[model samples]
Target: MAAVDAAADLLLTAARLPDRDGLVDIAVVGDRIASNGPASVAARGAIDLGGRLVTPGLVESHIHLDKALLSDRVSTTAGTLEEAIRVTAQAKRSFTVDDVRGRARRVLDMAVRNGTTAVRSHVEVDPGVGLTGLEALLPVREEYAPALDLQLCAFAQEGIIRAPGTEGLLRRALQMGADLIGGCPYTDSDPIGHIRTVFALATAFGVDADFHVDFSDEPLHMHVREIADQTVRLGWQGRVVVGHVTELAAIPPFEQDTVVAELAAAGVAVVCLPATDLYLMGRGDDINIRRGLAPIRRLLAAGVPVALASNNIRNPFTPVGTADLALLTFLVAVAAHMGSPADLRALVDTITVHPARMLRLPDYGLVPGCRADLVVWECARAEDIPATLPARTLVLKRGRVTVEAEHRVVERWR
Candidate 1:
């Protein structure tokens, strides 16, 4: 008789999964969800979830690893986005590979501990540094490849398409396996020309395009429309994502709806970065304090696919952040007016399924025949996420327990 397989890696029972309503047990056998059902689901050994909320691990759609590393050395007293950029430019000159790796690893570790399983970070490719930073991060990126599901966007922070020699650098990064081509059109000296050039490069390289566009409090900075128009013209629908659409909220109400409709029709996804926005934009104003977050609720109400991100973690613009979606949820709920229970549940889509679609991640969700990149957030209900932002009671990456939060109470004696 054949021997029964005895070494199952992980099993989680009595979990209140987020995607659906109910308490079910999840089994992870070999790098994917083996099966999910009642506690009776067969496994080598099962972990008692104790009726905690379980959801797919969080996905941070837009972040800058280069700047995330430089955060400690710089501090922005005034807290403006422009100031943060200036600080980063200065700090970038002194960063070594080891320095970048060490700081970035801290953020990633924090993210993993907080149950973020996937991320798409925009790593800048400077003219002098070339792709050294990106190249240095390759092994580390691959090290967490299965667990964290990382995708690197070789971003031309100085405008790849508009700046000389940057186009070649962008192409080389792509050849070196940069997952996406990123741009900062609003910050580019020639914004329109930069957009035109990057769009062509994305086409030529056959990679996805994610741009930091219209990150302005000014209503007149409607580069979002131009991006949508170009995306439609190139038939790059669903392949393009616009991060930080701050202008969408500042625009006229009627025009905002029109822009959303156009973007939705063009198959563009909008990413909102609450952490950095709340810190950077709308500062130095006595009245009319701007929240700086994108119009997430408005976009969702209009049926436009939207996602939330922790853009800057401990970066110059903002000196504090935990790589936790729960915090993002709370801040976004307040800023976007997502007050209802149903609204909160729907918000999970922005962090999970919405970003999966944005990054074209395959089989990312907890279902049959999917990668078992899952986290068991130990909370009772979806709304409970905000109140008790517990670490993943159980974490399975590619169906293996990479890291499990130990439950030990430390008693302090005075």
Candidate 2:
């Protein structure tokens, strides 16, 4: 390595860039991938990745910063979604800024260390807590600014219509630097009113809308249809996100395909929060226990972007999580019965490119001139990467090395 040039900060030699052939060299110039040039490049430093797979950094589309990591705080004695909500609501009443920050910090450390370069977290904003969670989290966004891109949605978990004064708090959060407006229609006294209020606020703030709609095992609650209608009516196409439309799984395939097509035409992206849903939903029925996921295959077939996410980590809603994207992918693969190699390869996109597309992240791929937010995996093929969940990896943010893990072993038998 020669004395580093000011313009070119680093050179990566023999790093197996994904979607490209033949162990090429990559250059990073001032936080951007410069070009795929000769291996003998002039830069300050060089890292020979030893022909490992270099991939775009992971993206977490739907996660909760405020209500995460609360598995021990409350017990889901009944083990139901309503019970989870009750417990979480009770816990939020005692949240101090430090408490919220501390919990959120743990989630961030867990995510960034595992190759997630971008996270869109939903922070609760309602009269009960009244912007305290967002107040605690805004600084965190600044704290991790150098390492990852964090976007906060002013989420109303308690339902805007049911929780009076919540609509006002959501507006305040958006004005106070929240990036998106969030809603949960099912929790509302008026599901339609809930959707209307949240979308109106999102439009008023010129921000995006992310909603938790139709999150039931029954097919009766079809708020997702109204959400799509509202998205088009507001001219908010491609700017709307709907999460946890699990009821689509129960609807007939023909009906599900029709709705998925409408969602696709409306340009609304869907997020499947498997971990929390798996734990919270399907606990009521004994016969024909539902998988309780969005119709992912049908959605993809209908040209809708459905991204997978770790919705909650070790909380009442979800009791187990390692905060690893690979683990999330693996669970979804098994739960959704995606067994084929092509299906597994498609699973990779739910955590990576698909979320990037949903979030519309600029400079967010492995191409030259993109941001150097990338991960280098120990595995050789992308399909094998998910099975090797949380493998030994190197993480780079803006062309700088941020996290590097050689390996881990709990028990080895040889």
Q: Which candidate leads in lDDT?
A: 2
Instruction: Give each model's whole-structure lDDT.
Output: 0.78, 0.86
Q: Write down the TM-score for model 1.
A: 0.93
Q: Write the per-residue lDDT of candidate 1 for residues 292-361, one digit (tens) a residue.
A: 7778877888877888888877878667787777788877777778868888776778888898899888
TM-score of 2: 0.95
Each candidate's clash count:
4, 1
Residue 330's C-alpha lDDT in candidate 1? 79
Candidate 1 Cα deviation (angstroms), residue 184:
0.5
Model 2 Cα displacement at 218 (Å)? 1.2
TM-score of each: 0.93, 0.95
